[model samples]
Target: MEGKEQNRQEGIPLQFCKNKTKRRDKSFNVYIKTFGCQMNKYDSEILEGLLKTRGFTLTPHIEYADIALFNTCSVREHAERRVYGQVNMLSPQICSLGKSKRGDNYPNKRIIGVIGCMAQAHKEKIFDRLPQVDLVCGPQNLYNIPDYLEDIAKNNKRILAVDRRERPVDRENFSFRNKRRYLTAYVTIMEGCNNFCSYCIVPFVRGREVSRPPSLIIKEIEVLIKKGAKEVTLLGQNVNSYGRDFNNGYNFIQLLKDIDKMHELRRLRFITSHPKDASDEMFIAMSKLPTVCESLHLPIQSGSDKILKSMNRKYTREDYLRKVDILRKLIPEVSLTTDIIVGFPNETDEDFAETIDIMKRVQFDTAYIFKYSPRPYTQAARLEDNVPKKVKEERHQELLRLQKNITLSNNKKLINRKVGVLVESADEKGDYLIGRSRTDKVVIFKGPKELIGKIVEVRIIDASLANLKGEWIRL
Candidate 1:
């Protein structure tokens, strides 16, 4: 541990402090703009928590911030492009601020940084792309942000802290700065990915899988519940493989069971379960755990066996179907959602048809469909992107159209049925409240503002492809 700390310190060099006398007495405010995934959002919360402890305040407005950070994603090309655009928009303003006169209200040296997957994936290249950025740190190095900022403030130096070493999860660093707007919160039980799915950049950027101790996870959720968080979603690249790195016999199922025993937690959820790791014991736990939500987001990138093989997903279509069948048998009310990629490299017409056929058979409650975009450092990137752009768009549209009808039909089945919804917030018009059912369906109904953090019963009156319209039955 001592050697590791020494090496970490050596990796991030501290230059001679020149502007130490110019340090201000005022508390610095940080503005974090997050993009992509629940994991990134949770990361931002941790960032704010750490900054707050170092006498920095969290500000929602970018213009009022002394430090502007972009917590970015590298999942898709568009996500990376969007972050670049955001950096472009903020760079000139930040540069202009640095050139302006120093005053009591305005600091002459405002720092800009990029943190998260994009920072890890791109590394030093981000400096070339966004010349005004003072820091580029990865997910693993986020805990060091306070130190990096302090160095920048004292020495006026650029810092890049993208350490890929396997670090143990620090439970204390996972704290949130303030109470959440809603009752639901996301708790990342594990970090990184071991599965090198051909289309995924997670393994490359997030490093290997490491699960937090089960006791730590339970303790975090318990604390959140005490702070009025009623719903918690466990996040991971592949949540089903959570305890594979440990030898104490605790796994994802046991973790869920432990969390389920928390009396104050109304809902327990998890995401991105691999079909190959969907064990029968897990299904049994889901069935028996009272607080566990009856919803699963199992991603089957492609329904075609050939494409699945090429993607190295390790599960056959039959294997996926069997798991789904088992889940449905155990929990009849379970809502199933999946992810689909339209144009993987060398995907044939029959492969595309198989995806559509599986969609028809499963009638997924919802599906996140995407046109394939090859990511750097992935196996798929080396393969020719054979599918034409026009063809990819057509396939994408076809799947969307098919799923729209299926979702509408599935939602229509709930018409006039009573369901319990955990009200989250008021809708835009303020005439109604919006909440989510246990199955994760968005339901809107007329209610008072007091219903925001409470669960109430509602009768489904109408349905659309995306949401359910309901009448409030009672709180």
Candidate 2:
């Protein structure tokens, strides 16, 4: 997977189907399973759009589908393990034995594919491990999926397309699949990362930073807004590094200001801001923009300057603290969230203590703590994984317990306060509506189904570590 191969294997050019605008077909169903983060979810939507244009239906059940695609993540060893487990389970059930729904019996099997980051990272290794897979496509080469499927059906041969090319995105049609549209949408403003954090594999799989043209993004958001989408989250690896690839002075702040001017847009959000790129202008835009949500996800992988330096994070503990201060000062009621890695190579007790101390000071509303897993071809992988499993588990539990208390304390402060929530869905019993506040906290309250896509006011009455119970108020 690490070694580069020809852009296409076995003379398969990266291309889309000629008849992409054909009417949708009800027979062929594509069941997709997505793992990892919001970026993968957005990528799945892109796949849905591409398949839909070629007349395939999206199905929730895997039993009835003619094709199955696994959109994978390679961020953590746990994620990779889960994908392998699922694929292994699927091999005996659907590979080589099952017949296609079309009853052609030429191939005599359902088409199985491995796509996204994992496919890009592992390449032909997947074929060696899982012989039942018919197609493998990387994130950048998604547009070639339909054509590859056709070739597999015709030639009965395996196809692998993990070429690192500057592929163009079909923004006009592929922004969000029409069949599975949601009120809250995710639009990618940029792709890939430039920061090669020592412990991360994103740069290897996703390539360098490339910003989508501002006009295309604005156009896509306008379309989503017209389709009754009330909220939009811009997806990226590190959103703070958005426009660095461009020579023009236009950057992330300007992008937000332009998008904020849309009168119909109710709320806007973004994720995974790098601490090194945190800027005063960006915070100011978030503070003043009416449509931008007050929630921010800034990842500070470590608080120990020593560990931080080894991770190639480029920012120190003091630098992170200052950024947090600026954000709090600009948006006093802002909800802060972060990512923390507990076990790194050669982490000492003092390093772990620094992480605990910073968590206490920041009091993040939420934190995603992960036990470090050494990935192949990474700098950290070369170091001795000195921390034992028992110690890592202990540190991980300690962080979780501390964060639980902090989250409960923060939620308690919201009691008796009015917050605006965009109603997203309802519980199975239909007795309660679930939505998120501007601060990105889940708030559930009794409401009519008619209020699903609207932003309504809710007064917090009870608080919990997971969510808040609120009383509905008129918009």
Model 2 weakest 10-residue run by lDDT: 13-22
Model 2, 194-286: lDDT tens digits are 888999999899989899889988988888888888899999898988888898888999999999999899999998799999899899999
Q: What is the TM-score of each predicted model, taking all chains together?
A: 0.91, 0.92
lDDT of 1 by residue, 188-257 (tens): 8888898899999999889999898888788888778877898999999889998988987878988888
Q: What Cα-based lDDT does every candidate model obtain?
A: 0.83, 0.84
Report the CA-based lDDT of candidate 2 relative to the real structure: 0.84
Which residue runs does candidate 1 get wrong by more than 4 Å? 1-25, 94-109, 166-177
Query: Who wins the TM-score comparison?
Result: 2
Q: Which residue pairs come into collision in candidate 1?
A: none
Positional deviation of residue 229's Cα in model 2 after best superposition, in angstroms: 0.9
